[model samples]
Target chain A: MSKIKVENLTKVFGKQKKRALQLLKEGQTKKDILEKTGCTVGVNQANFTVEEGEIFVIMGLSGSGKSTLVRMLNRLIDPTSGSVFIDSEDISKVNDDQLRQIRRKTISMVFQRFALFPHRTVLENTAYGLEVQGIPKNKREDRAMETLQMVGLKGYEHQLPSQLSGGMQQRVGLARALTNDPDILLMDEAFSALDPLIRKDMQDELIELQSAMQKTIVFITHDLDEALRIGDRIALMKDGVIVQIGTPEEILTDPANEYVERFVEDVDWSKVLQAENVMKRAEMITLDKDGPRVALNRMRETGLSSLFAVDRRNRLQGVLSADAAKQAIDEGKPLADLIERDIVKVRPDTLLNDIMVQMAETNHPVAVVSDDDRVRGVIVRGSVIGALTGKEVKTHD
Target chain B: MTESIPKLPLADVVEVIVSWLQANVGWLFDFISNLIEPTVAFFTAVLMFLPTLVTIVLIAALTWWLSSWRIALFTLIGLMLIANLGYWEESAQTTALVLTATVISIIIGVPIGILCGKNDTARNIITPILDFMQTMPAFVYLVPAVIFFSLGTVPGVIASVVFSMPPTIRLTNLGIRQVPEDLIEASDAFGSTSSQKLFKIQLPLAKTTIMAGINQTIMLALSMVVIASMIGARGLGEAVLTAVQRIEVGTGFEAGLAIVIIAIVLDRLTQNLGQGNGQHPRN
Candidate 1:
């Protein structure tokens, strides 16, 4: 079930009469005036359903409204229009007092700036949301301590926000957002402000936290790589509109438009796209009784240089490269004896990014697919490349 | 022999310093006043050129615009009514006196503010004095003015100036101190001179806070107008005092309402002018 849902949200600023008067007085051109007074359409027709325990990421550049969209989920900023449902209840129209109750108990947010009250110590800042919910001070402190320990900030709870490094401050922000035991956590570029090394550490820390307590998270960032690293599903935003939403592998392999393609263009596909996407289906290829020669020729026809040499029932076959087969045939060796065994393999479920890494490291062009040592199919560099570049692949979903 | 030779008492050294200060006091005050007098005189003259009726209406309209139009309309109506009710001349006199006093206070107070902002020692030394100046009753300041300058507009001006000056100085110092360190560093990196840094960056950043202080100073000066009338300064304060003495309820009420109108107007105009230039002055 979806934990949070947002639909068609919008926000426009400077609607007051004085602002209108000022605009008229300034003698601004219609275009400039319109730009200044225009409706931001902050979350234009935004619609999303985040499942329970999902780490859904909203990725966008600055001013693309990802932060604004996340802020609406917790009612930090009211939407100009649209509805938000948290746990099946519409919270868009909730009054300030009721919203406060919802925020205190149902959803918590960590700001990119780590908006920990500068005057407060780490422990106090973490405990604030709980205190607002009327939790006893001592109990809240204890809970805050537990959260601090969870975020690896156990030794530094007494320090001020200014006293901590950027990473530590963000951990404090994370701890504070989580201390209330809310069902949903909204992180608005929570680690983007930190140093690169520190950002990675915080991402790993968040993964560890989510593994133990799988509250739904809507994290926002401008970094596509970070989104892919952390997100269970990602919503890519452009100009206040959601361009696409899906798993990292889906986005990497099947971008919706040229905009998304431009974003992913410089990405190292060998490290990002997985081998499972390119893995051939065993039933799709015909097995020849003529053995390896026939299979190699069929691979060349299929634009693959290698084939999986299988038995009559299609079980326990090894890879047959055309070059290897030809060399063995010329050397007067039996085709079955010459066929190389112990080829690299991939499960259909392995992420494309992981498979690409393995392929690059091992310099393997073709990987064998098997079901318990029974040959499934041969996945070659060309097939995977086509899949990575968003070409249509004839494969089962 | 060294132990037997006792040091001269500290009082002897203090006495000599006091004598020297007394001799130089007139020269010091003259030189400082000469340095400040032209700026103060310039604004004061410009302010006086504004016709009394226009000043009242302009100030009221400005205050209303910055705060709320509703408040502005009420203030404008109030000022006109106060004039029609025969308190117009007195209200004008009070407006003139308060504006003059506030302007003078800013001139003198801003320099002290700069000093306090630039020097840690000055800030530390002057902070307690500022606290005392802010907290002490406006009436207490009159006691010193009465003893030194005697009674009337001049003495009342002196007393009102002391009461109103602290906020400007304190706020200016605070505003300067609050300027972002990164911005200051960037200025330095660009090879900006001290004066350039002060004028271009620090002062501009502190403008909002300084304006707020000026607003507070004006309000304080307005409040003192009625009290200063007890010593013989004329205006709305005198009208209110006379009405009170003679038990003229209508007169007193009109005069009191006039002060409120004037307060609203002055408050708004300063606020708008300070906040208007398309930059949010960080308070």
Candidate 2:
């Protein structure tokens, strides 16, 4: 089910909203509209749908209107024109009472500045959503306590938000949002205020939490790396308009425009390009059929240091190094006898950053295998270096 | 040289308006006086009915409860000094008058402040009116107040309210408006109604500032006591007024000293009301 669907949603701040909307519809740029109508386009003609249990990231630079766009999702700022549908109800058209009811039951937001009530203790801040809903005190606190513990804030329940570090404060913010158990969670720069190391931990924690809870999330951020790390799909925005939306691999490998291309140019490829993206088609000898002679001949022809050994089903068995294969042929041994069964293997989805660690742990090449144990690709040290230095990694057959 | 603007007849215009209000709303004014007089009188009577030593101990105990023992000690010493100076009744009356004005100011001011804080248009409309109220000379309010309530503590109270209310209203508005924008947004995003947001979020965060405003109102009301005495209001102001007429320096100084002691005690009491609520995060 589509938990949220925004259609032609627009917000123009200031008095001349109608004029600004008209100018925007006529294709005037945000700056041009601001000059002509004295109105700034906050979010210009946004349209997207969030499916159930997906983390949809809205990534952009400052003033790109991503923050404004996420605020529109929960009707925090009323749309000057357009519709926001949450769980198929047109929230933009809902009356104040109806909108509030939807906000209470269907959506909650986490803020950039860790907007935990400074006066409220951690437990009180976490329980605020339920408190607004008028849930009984004992019941709400019980639920809030569970969420606080879930966010790793078990012992700090009575401490105020200002007493915590920025990262800890945001955990309370996230716990506050989750206590309502809303289907859609809107996180507006929730991790942007934290330092880089803490932000990475938070991003990892959010991804971990999302898998267990399966809430549809609309995450807004200026950090492309953070977006790519947690987002199931990313919508790149510019100047109040969404330029493109795609998966992490699609965005990194196939940018839709020069703006997106430049925006993603500085992203660390080792984090984004996965094993499948950076790997080459693996060459292996069939352990049940191929002899040591075949493995040695193939290694010599390809100028490769090692070859993978696989069963007849093409399932990975082990690896055969040039030294082992040559020693096997000299000693008149079978291919299986020379196959090193203890070589490290990774799934095709493993990140290059992880593969780099695995590569450093051993002398053997990393084999990318499928879930069912078929050898899909291989990551050589040369290939890993090429991928780290190159902007685009070309997967060779 | 003759004035080019024809002198504006502003004084005559104001007098005519006051006369018209007195004619039409004479009963309304009487009703308001009836309401205010009894409340002020009841509190004054209770304070007067108590033995001087008993009242001082009671007030000192109250200060001890509301604030630290240090302020309680100061209040105890100050009240005893006022009693020792033979101005006990006058001190009691002034305390009663100031407390009544402070209560009325808060009751009438906080709602108007909330309105101005939440609505920009309301704020713009009220801001200039507040400026006029504050900038007008303090004694000028006596004319219409005497016309409406006809002289006594009622008119005195009416004038003091007009004088002291602006600070309460202005500070309340500022406190509410100064609450962090992100907190307001957080409340809104959580489905809080305007009232819910006001009570649960804005007001709590603004409590310290609003308390400061109330403290200002009390101090201003106390300052207005001597000025309010020009009408028939009784208190230390009347004692001071009587001394001025007789040229008795010792008597005037004693009454004046009593007022100063009372002001300090009230100031300390109200000033301590905002403390130790866990308002700020512990370091």
Candidate 3:
């Protein structure tokens, strides 16, 4: 089962909820429904499932219901209709006590404004969730200390939140959520309030933390770039409805609608598109099986100066240049002797921006390798430049 | 003959209501008075029992602890002046009365303020009542105080509480309402119960504002001392009243000066306490 499954979740903020829901069922726009019923649609028919340990991002412009949708996941904002199933239990149907248990034991949240209690010490703020759980003081503090240390706030425990800088205060907020050790983290615009540099640092920190902790995070943001950088799957919200849900590559390459297209149009493609998206199938030869003559023929046919030489298992051995191939064929040497091992190799997930750098520093195309060192594909310098310039590059299985 | 304009009988309406309350709910007033009497008496007796020199020294030390030495020195010199002028005992009695009234007002005001703060309907209902309590003349409360508790320190304490309580209520409500929405959400997001949120997050963050409210309450109670004296409550107010009745300029000046000195000391101490620092200046 998915870690969280939300189906037809909706929220209407005002008294005329019945009318609003009717209009919603009739497929009225948010503005038309508001004009007709005087009830604002906060979220409309939001349906998605968050996989375990996935960083699922909900992104939108302000008032697009992204924040409202996340709040519904934890039942902080009750849904007007439909349900959210966490671990196969519909949280919308849970009682107050059960909801609180869900919040305490299953889900914890980091807020946009770094909502640390100003009167509380850093340690006390970090321990707030554990304290709410009725844990003993010493035990809670010990756990809070460890969480604080994990967030890189070791020696600053006794200081009040007001005494700390904005970034440090946000770390305390993060530590507060982490101390609960919950399965799902609902971060509502968690880094939007920080300085640009600090925001980037915090995003990096969250990514690093997620890799280590493997917590399912449903992060909310209005920033497409942030979503692209950190999200495993992104749900793009617009006008109280989720317009699209896809991976960053899919969102960038094939938007679900015009709104999604325009939303992603301004994103730097070099950063968003990885080697997997830009790579083309390159003609290659197995070093153990293919002779230099075969390598030369393949290179000539592909109209390339070199070909990647791999083992029978497709593990990359090295590159075979046209000169080396011809020299090997004349000297009757093995293809292994002619192979050059100095070429750059990248993983499929390595960003095109980094691949561009590699392309700039080398004359040969970079080889895309799998974790097992098998050659997946090759990214030519032309492909990197073409992808950045918005030309479609052929991708293969 | 020109048509005469009809007069509105607001005063008669109030008089009838007061009479009805006096007749029907007199026992309730007696019960409240019974509760308040001992508290006022105990505080009064303690303040009067402490030797004037000891009281002065202790107050000066407390002021020094809570605020700057300048204010402390000011308090020391001010208390000595009152003692030299032979009004120290009366000043102490007035201080006791203000303390009693402030404590009672806080007891009545804070929870009501919290209710108003938490619920919009409660706030809408209580706001007009608070306006009435605040805007009504101080002397108007005395008429009901006398009818309920009769002429003495108890009636004076009751009147002072009624007059001074509004600021505490209004400000406490404002303070709690002013607690940032995000912080309240954070508390809720952490699964805090309603009472836990109030105590742990709301109250602590609202401390400065609530303390400001208490400071206003005490100051308002102090302002009521002389007015309360007309209903037979004793203190520096009595001395001032006596001076006024006898037309003694020297006595009135001394008593007035003593009241001013007490007001300054109370104001500085409470203001400093409201700032949430009793030890030293904030960096």
Candidate 4:
């Protein structure tokens, strides 16, 4: 089931909220509504869902309402209209006490500024959410210590936040949120304050932690690259409305509008598009069923110098060149002897940029494999050049 | 021909209000005075009971604890000078009065300040009143204090508390209001109740500003010692008043020097205390 479902969530800020809502319903632009009613539209008709264990990113430029939308999920900013369902429960309708309970038990948030209490020690800050839940002091500390270790902050418990570096402080922030073991994590530009190197480290750490913990995370960022790197699905917002929501590849290759296309224009596609995006289905011979004669025939038919030899289950055995196949067929040798196992193999998710270097080192095409060693497709130099130069290569299944 | 502007009956208006309060809420005034009288008496008695040398030693030790030994040495020498001049007892009485007024002011001011900080209506109502309290001449409050408590140390303390409370309340409110918006949001996001946020986040982060407020209140209360003496309150102010009545320049100079000595000691001690609290290492 989807962990969070937000439907038609809208927030209007200022005195004439009802008028603003009316203007919004009347289909006036945010600027027009602001001029007409003197109220700013913070968020407008945002709708999206975060599936279980997915890293769903909400991204936009400053003043695009990405932060406002995230806040509305937890009801930190009460919506003028619409509802947010968490685990099928509409959090927008919960009373203050139930809201508090939900915030304590269901969702925890990390802030842009690493809003750790400057007065509290690292341990105290990390254990803050658990403390709010009234966990016993000893148990809370134990859980907090475990989380701290998970976030790579094992020895700095007694130190104050001021004493830690910016990266360390954010780790403490992450540790604080994780200490509660909540079902969903709402991270609002949590790494935006750190330097680039540190931000990258934190992003990598978050991805690692997400893999291990498998918690549904709704991450907010203004950085497109960060969204592409970490998000399972990304929602691009503009002017208080979500413009498009799709996977990183879909958002890059099939942007819904000119705005989205312009937003992604500067992105380095080679880093985003993977081997699966550029790989083509390869002609292959079954090693158990087909001999060297079949391999040679398939290579000639496909007009390829070499063909992959695979088992009956399509697990890659080796590559067989036409010369080796011909020698094997004349000598009456098994196809295994003719097969070459020295060719490079890569996973389907390997980035095109990474594959570029591997392709440069060898003169042969690279085979893309699934986790169970099944050959899915093969990436040739032409396909890599085609994808990098904006030619659409048929993506692998 | 000249046009005469109508005379404003501000003093008459004040006199009427004072009389009405005295008639209707006189028991409230009595109850407050009754409550504060023993605390004042207790502090005064303790100061009077301690020997001059012992009191000097204790104050010097407090100075040493709060600041450096250099300030403590100055305190020791200064107190000895007052003792030698035969003004030690008056200085003790003044210290007692200032301490009593400062304590009472903080107790009343801090909560009001916190309330003002949290609520817009309370802030709006209290801000103008605070402005009037701070800008009014210190002697004006003594009249109402004398009328309500009627000629004693209690009246002096009440007047001093009235004069000194505005800074504490104003600074406390400002301190809490100045707490970063992100921190408040973080606390709220974590599901902290209002009281928990106040105590844990707002109060702790506002400590330095509140300490500054306390320091200002202490200074203002000390400034009221001479004015408070007019209501028959005993202290070095009384000694100065007596010397002025007799026009004895030498006596006045000696009493005046003792008051100065007492002021320096109290100022240094309180300033050090505030600074000490402000500089508490992160924990």
> How large is the interface RMSD of each prediction?
17.3, 1.5, 2.3, 1.1
- Clash pairs, model 2 backbone: none
Please list the C-alpha lDDT of all candidates, in the order they appear: 0.74, 0.89, 0.90, 0.89
Off-target runs (Cα >4 Å) in candidate 4 are A287-300, A326-335, A395-397, B1-8, B281-283
Residue range B116-228, candidate 1, lDDT tens digits? 99899999999999899889988887865654445666657777889999999999999889987644542332223467568756787688889989999999999999899
User: Could you give the fnat of all candidates in order?
Assistant: 0.00, 0.84, 0.70, 0.59
Clashes of each: 5, 0, 0, 0
How high is each candidate's TM-score? Answer: 0.54, 0.96, 0.95, 0.95
lDDT by residue (tens digit), candidate 1, A1-397: 6888776665434464344335534644334544766623455668899999999999988878787788778666677667899988888887656776777677877777776655457897788776655679899999999999988899898877788989888888888888878888888888989999989888888998899999999999999889988999999998777899988877876789988888877765545544455676542222346644565667667866666666667664566667876876578666677666665667655666666666776543445454565654556556777876667444346
Task: For candidate 4, report its TM-score.
Answer: 0.95
DockQ of 1: 0.02
> Once model 3 is optimally superposed onto the true structure by TM-score, how far is the C-alpha of residue B236 displaced, in angstroms?
1.3
Q: Tens-digit lDDT track for model 4 on B157-228?
A: 999999999999999999999999988988888888888889889998887788788888888888888888
Candidate 4 lDDT, tens digit per residue, A1-397?
Answer: 8889999899999999998988888889999998988899999998999999999999999999999999998888999899999999999998999999988888989999999999898999998887877889999999999999999899999989999999999999889988888899999999999999999999999999899999999999999999999999999999999999999888988889999999998888798889888989888999899987777777778899998889999999889889889899789888888788888899988999899898888877899999998998999988888888766745444
- Could you tell me the TM-score of chain B in model 3? 0.93
By TM-score, is 2 or 3 better? Answer: 2
Each candidate's DockQ = 0.02, 0.74, 0.63, 0.71
**Rank list by TM-score:** 2, 4, 3, 1
Q: What is the lDDT of candidate 1?
A: 0.74
